[model samples]
Target: MDATIEDPRLSTSVEVVFAKQHMPDLRGQVTLRAMAVSVVLGIVFCFVGMRIQLTTGLVPALNMPASVLCFFLLKSLVRLLQKGGFAVLPFTRQENMFLLTCVITCLNLAITGGFATALTGMTSTVAKTLADDPDPRDIVDNVPTGKWILFFFLIGMAGVLSNVPFNQVMIIDYKLLFPTGTVVGQLVNSFHTPEGAYVAKMQVMTIFKAFFGSFSWSIFQWFYTSGNGCGFQSFPSFGLGLYKRRFYFDFSATYIGLGMICPHIVNFGLLFGAIVSWGFLYPFLESKRGQWYETDSPSSLSGLNGYKVFISVALIVTDGLINFITLVTSAAINFYQIRQERDSSELTNYINKLHPSLNYDDRKRIEVFLANRIPVSGPVAGYIACAAISTVAIPAMFSQIKFYHVAMLYMAIPVVGFCNTYATGLTDWSVTPTYAKFVIFVLAAWIGRPGAVVASLLASGITMASLHVSSQAMQDLKSGYMTLTLPRAMVTGQLFGVALSSVVGPCIFLAFQNSTKPGAPVGSKQSNYPCPYAALYRAIGIIGMGGVKELPKYCIELCVISVCVTVAIDTAVLISQKRGWSIHSYIPSMTVIALPFFTGPFFAIDMCVGALLLLLWRRMEAGSAQLLSSSVAAGMICGEGLFTLPSVLLNMFKVLPPMCMKFLPGGQEVEVVDSFLNNSGASRA
Candidate 1:
């Protein structure tokens, strides 16, 4: 091949060697046998992982230490069985880098989780931080917000950031188990760096995207966690002074992505059952007068069953209903998305108009085509909102308790998040609309609910979605973005993410609840978007529609500054268009992000050091990335926040003891196998 003739491929067939690109292999080549097998394995792996995640709470740690360790060993075993005749965890240069990163990350988690626990213990009573609530000893008031500030900071460091090493090691650094027939290999991610200036934008956008998306979790956390609640603690409504919100309704955690997003709906199903059994069934099943004096309690209604039985029945009934709705909605969404994409008539319109803006070149044409297909804000979201509102309102209507509140609530949250630079990125705004920026400016003016808080929030969310689409478009146009291949397609993964997040949210919220605080709730559930905003808007809603005057000039100043910064970078990109700069070339300062998040007196900065070290290994040696990533996983298992620890510990005790008894030199169990083998049919004969 001549150098003048550009191949436009990663590497030519003959030139591809393990020395380059790490993936330089014949496996990637399209072959009848290899392709078929890859396809089958991919599909099977994906099927198992996705379905398991539906109810398993497995994903959180599956890609981490315990699982990572097991998988690595298995990978080694597979290699041993291969023609190479070597069985080893591919502790290539990359794996080493990954392990280093994990070591640092684990150190960080330990420091942060430990410090926070210690601080909480020392500053407050032990009963306060660890236990449920305060005693009935009639004590003095405490500083709730102060407690929460500490709580949230520590939790963020240990749970989210500190775990990055493990995540990178497990997912990015390894060949993941992906679904069949997908571009991503079986359980492994397949990502490519895009060409041109857009790459920088994509990289920056990813950081912000991840930050904003994950930060949104805080909204749900604000409601349920009394220790860190915005104002959702046991407010003295009934006048006893302290009440934990957990005892009321734990709606936030029902669906936050582990399960279905709406646990309450499922609970409502149980409520329905209660109505049937108590109102009708129990009335008829009364032994003579079983129905006559069966008061409010469920136990009394049932003839001789213990209260525990009733409680168990209630839980089962509620969980079932929630799961049923969740399953249906999830299926409907997936089907609708698939069908809408397949049957879209817009393709024809887009095809006809492609010539004007897009280059005739095949690559350019493909990019443009994908760009147009990216949906904008407001296509399906409004309907989804309307459905949610109607469902909530139907129950309210029957109960005669007006829920005009939620009607307005369903309208607002997204836009507010966008204005705060934390857009949910729910909607794809491939095309920006006129006056969108101005509307955002107006909405972002206030801190909370001005009379129509819901509308404002909805507008903000839609606007943010639109902006995200625009950002994606910019990256597409610029050609500098590094595309990320989440092993799981975002659509399905996002659905699962939402479900799990929502389900765990309420539990997290309840854990952090504290009466004395005022701010976003801790471990707040995102199931009900309003749960966070309700108190916030209630607090600052006085700013009103004419909030333009009330808006802090500083906030506006910050927005302007951000816009100016974005434009300056854009200008730089435009100047460098002819001779492109690697997207990283232009990003001058990560200092702002690094100080509070990466460094400072917070958690041990060792984790960030570890991550940075891994990055270094990527450049210095081949295969280092894989090595470092695996190491990180091992380190994390030995660190804080071990999600699947207990189960594995039990399994270890079960399997290890038996294995030790049999395999250890001079052990008692060696004779057992020997005796059993001797008693076999052949021996007996």
Candidate 2:
């Protein structure tokens, strides 16, 4: 890497390579086109995604967060291409189309049936417990719309606060208007000619817009009233029918019910946090950590890849089982519905109960039976359970086990969430309304949940890693587009990102889990479920079966191997790419893809493979272009990071008094945190 030659005559290979990398004359129309292409592609994909959502029962996020993702990835690719040239941006339209189509299909399947994915792991566990019991299948079918709405509304309220912190962090990275700082001292270059709008018409449109926007989401829920099932369903029990509605529980969902949703950048931010905290700082915390920071800028923190892989393997395998369970759960429900339909008597009974003219054949009795027979449960703190489980597991796994517990902690929140929230529920991890009573089950079977934790960790880590890598790669991609150093930029990018996630980690704990739920104000949907875990315990009190008090050897062995895979995959990835790429990347993905294939099909694998291919293509580029590609990938992780950013910042508002001046006269002119990325900008620029 040392470019200076002792003698002018001693022209080294390093010097030659360095000169080629700094190509400046290539900038011109091509760069503009790349920018334009990125924007155009973003809009195109957005509309395509919207159309798909409308045309099919499938939503894009089922396979991928296609809408925002399209924008981020395309932008990253276009810039990478422009910097590295057209050849650097490889496109396999055949594979991409195939992948897209597959994703769409998977989206349909997932919406229709992919319950056992990364999001549904813990949730499915609870459902299974309920199903296994002889209790009526009422809870899932009879929740009130108001209650469902309230649960989500509270979750939304808890999450939206992250927006501010997230946006601030994002603004620091994206260089929104520019790739750096805000433009200042604008001269009157172009005159608007003081154009004025029709005041009366403007006011009316604004009023109408406000009204429609406020009620739009509510109105949209009408379509789902019929058993079309898009999170929460209402079944009329008494005179109506047994209402079995779902509450909101999208594993990858970053949206609040508010008009706004979490953007892709936040996903990148979360990734940024993981890379810095785990990938970067972790090694320093390790014996081999010197490789991460001891040498120089652009230091490859590839060492942490093992930690990621190790954790991921455990999660991926368990998750696959969880996904299979989801398929079975959905199939069971569908089959049960079909069986009910075949029974003329059952059909007649159901119809009569729904009849407007239910003759006095015991209408009061029917109402009473409906009231007590079925209780539709709302979204539970199952995902929170995964997070909490990770929180507990962190110290144990890392300190006692002496491998990489932090990685385990970080990975489990999302990965476990992905699995347990699914439908069928992993055999290892169970979910049932009755299981909700087993809050103490965790204390009993902490290790059993490691599989669950791995799933959650994957959810969190992959989300983070994908986002961080993509974003950093994107930034490095600018040929003359940026002047930052690749290694420096990578680290700096992570700093701003982790700063956002620091709060997200805990917010998920407090909000969705709502630690202060019982303390919530009167009438607040936030429950006063005094020791709901007691209920879980009481529900499972028969065998004391909630979490694993005694997991089978096969299950324990599987978890042990899974943990090994997690570390192995992370290590392989970290150490894999010496010249171009190392062994780590493909191994972890292989382990994941391989896990659930035998049990059932993961149609969404199509999209992921495509993404992997894209990642590979960028990885081969290996320089500026690689930087760009990784940046987009990192976007996924950052999205999660952005989730808690606002709360993190808001919590600091008290310390940042006279806040008005942050924007005023001589406020501290802040630069992008990635300034460390600049080979020369850390000082003057």
TM-score of each model, paired residue for residue = 0.30, 0.26
Candidate 1 global TM-score: 0.30
Give the worst 10-residue stretch by lDDT in candidate 1: 595-604
lDDT per residue for candidate 2 within 1-685, as digits (tens), equals 1112233233432223223233222122123333333333333332223222211112223212322232234435655777875654332211122122222221221121111221222232323322332222111222233332222222222122111122211212211222211110010000101211132223223333433442343334333422122212122221221111111122221121110121222222223333343434334535554543242212111223223322333454344444345445664564466446445444335445435353332232232222222112211242344334444443442222212333443333233223222222112222321122222233223433223322232222223222222222222222111121122222222222232222222223233232222233111112211111111221222122242232222334544766565556544544565446734333433333332211111112222333444545656775633323323332322332233333234334532212111111222333442344474665666
Q: Give the least accurate 10-residue stretch of model 2, judged by summed lDDT.
A: 183-192
**Candidate 2 local Cα displacement, residue 164, angstroms:** 1.4
Residue 195, model 1, lDDT: 34
Error of 2 at 623 (Å): 21
Task: Tell me the lDDT of model 1 at 48.
Answer: 21
Q: Report how far residue 521 has shifted in candidate 1, in Å.
A: 8.3
lDDT per residue for candidate 1 within 378-461, as digits (tens), equals 324533444364436432322211244333323332332222211111111111211222332344344233223223322332
lDDT of 2 at 142: 27
Error of 1 at 645 (Å): 11
> Relative to the true structure, how large is the alpha-carbon lDDT of every model?
0.27, 0.28
